[model samples]
Target chain A: MSHSSPASSEISFVQHHDDGTFKKTVRKVTIILSVVTIIELLCGLAIFKLGHGSHMAVLMIKGLVTILSLAKAFYITSYFMHLGDEIRNFIMTIIVPLLLFVWFIAAFLIDGSSWRELKNTAAGSKPATEQVEKAVAPGDKK
Target chain B: MSSAAIPAGTKWWSGGKSPFNLSYGKMMMWYFLMSDAFTFGAFLIAYGTTRFSANYWPDPNHVFDSAPFIHGGAPLVFVSIMTFILIVSSVTMVLAVHEGHNMNRKGVEKYMLWTILGGLAFLGCQAWEWTHLLTGDNPVLVNGEIVEMATTVKVNPWGEVVPGMMHNGHQVTTPGPVAFGGFFFGITGFHGFHVLSGVVINIIMYIKTRLGHFDQRGHYEMIEKAGLYWHFVDLVWVFVFLCFYLI
Candidate 1:
């Protein structure tokens, strides 16, 4: 608190220095986001037209759109949130914990399917053994 | 400016300077956003699990096949407008932060106003959608009887259409999974709340800029922090758009 020249001292400590491409980078990212969203919407339309009977095609398009949304998320966080410009350690601090989501999602989805199987078996609507054979494609069952 | 004068052997962890070279406020804000991300992630994952368990979930295309004024069908059209609004608002927010970096108070204020307006516009769109879902009547057959239903937490009228069933000139349908309406309203309402708060924060930042508070302080880090929150809101919308509208 007693240090002199606080302005000069504080200025150098700032991390996101202007490298003369700040505006250009922002514009590029904006275009990228818009394009990615357009592609995602188009993929959505494709899935809608494919209808539920063509389950494989709908799933593939949904996967593509999910990847596209992730790309949009990357641009938003890396550029808009300035996370990309932060120190490496700081970036890791935000990212490392996020890795937990992988297991969180996987476990929940598997458990949900397991619960459905349990309900089917308890009801005796379908034997457990036959369910395995039928489970190959929910589409076929539908 | 002593960053350049430090010797090679200087221990970054042994000094008063931040090892991350970030202000405490900014670092805390980043961590807060990280936690918030998990919250939304959990909500979405739960919704996914429920969907996976159900044999027949309502198709988003069929469920969202109407717009504000176009009575019949415009699949993915209105929601795209909302997504576009959010993306443009995020761009304006980053511009506001950029202006803040340059200490240009006028630029910051201008961009902040646009961001606030965009946020409000999104909220308005959400309000209209929820109202439509709550009030629009759709006839469905529940246990072999024709009944009028609106999408709500305990009820869903978007089930598969039954063959040879028609009521009041509308196609009669079976009842949909109740969890559908629950998750839809739960996740989206939470997201809309975040957008509302983001606008509030942007408003405060705008007032600060207008009052020259940041100018007197010699920096606009406040605007940058608020921008971070605003962009996080937009980022969440990207995923929401994916889960709810697109897929």
Candidate 2:
């Protein structure tokens, strides 16, 4: 029941008792996040406003935007969500599985495109065979 | 009689409070969020694969060209604003959690209110964007006919016009459109639902804070928990913004 005890102190919600430090940390994080977001927006605009560049250039810009956005995601998750302050193992517990999930996506996307090609080929051949059959069939004369 | 059974030392599996230094509720929330991330990942991946397979996919710049109040070809201006709003809201949410840590009820209340307002404003922006999308002219040209592109499960205004498939003997749509529209609606709609729910939760927490609920309970873990959820919503939006608007 004593607030002075170590166990009771651990249970308290406020981690850093210094009010100034907490406020400053929050303010710093907000500024960093805003700056990163603005950069992403500018990069996005540059891609189109610059007249699509080349096909390869456009792809490069798109890739850059994705990376900037991922940076934004990192800041929000680490600082805003307090993941940075959490234990190392805890962070890995969330991140390792997410990386695996990304791998899952890459694998499946490759498979999907292959299937699409197969389907397109099958559809192309099927109609041609039907047209040939129509000319040869005796019932078509009726 | 049970001295050995109690474990001689503080092993890693020692039964106690927050072995990982996280509250049980917070840990559970993290697990829930991880699972939720997978669901969103699947939706985005589906969109990516579908786009890759298509011969002609709608350019995001041309598709999302309209901004509120400043008409005439401003690509992603509106979505950029929405992203800023969500990120700002996330900042407020973190500040609220920080205040909660200090046991400052007034600080928590003030910041929470701001966070809730940010969420509502973001939703408003989304509604405007959706309206523009549904009602605005389809950017893609098809046989000199103006086809109004709207989000539909059956038709895709973004894809090439399909031939021979008809509703009442008129050719309806192309095969590419369905996947575009489907993923667009499915992923964004799911994220919107989460935002809506986050708003509701924030309001509930706001009311409780006003009523001195945490003060009575002697801790503000509830606010921290709610903060986690709000931040997750913002985090998810970053990806949604990339998939739909920027990319």
Instruction: Give the C-alpha miss distance for residue B239 in model 1, angstroms.
Output: 0.9
Worst 10 residues of 1 chain A by lDDT: A1-10
Against the true structure, whose TM-score is highest?
1
TM-scores for the candidates:
0.90, 0.82
Residues A18-128, candidate 2: write the lDDT tens digits: 567667777887888788777877777887776545778877878898888788788778767878767666788888988976688778778778756865786744755
What DockQ does each listed candidate score? Answer: 0.29, 0.26
Clashing residue pairs, backbone N/CA/C < 3 A, model 1: none
Model 1, chain B only, scores a TM-score of 0.95
Q: Candidate 1 regions off by >4 Å?
A: A1-12, A16-20, A122-142, B1-10
* DockQ winner: 1
**In model 2, which runs have C-alpha deviations exceeding 4 angstroms?**
A1-17, A50-53, A116-142, B1-12, B139-151, B159-176
lDDT of 1 by residue, B16-99 (tens): 666776777878899999999999999999999888887788988888888888765678998999999999999999988888
- As a whole number from 0 to 100, the lDDT of residue B145 in candidate 2 is 48
CAPRI-style quality class for the chain A–B interface of candidate 2: acceptable
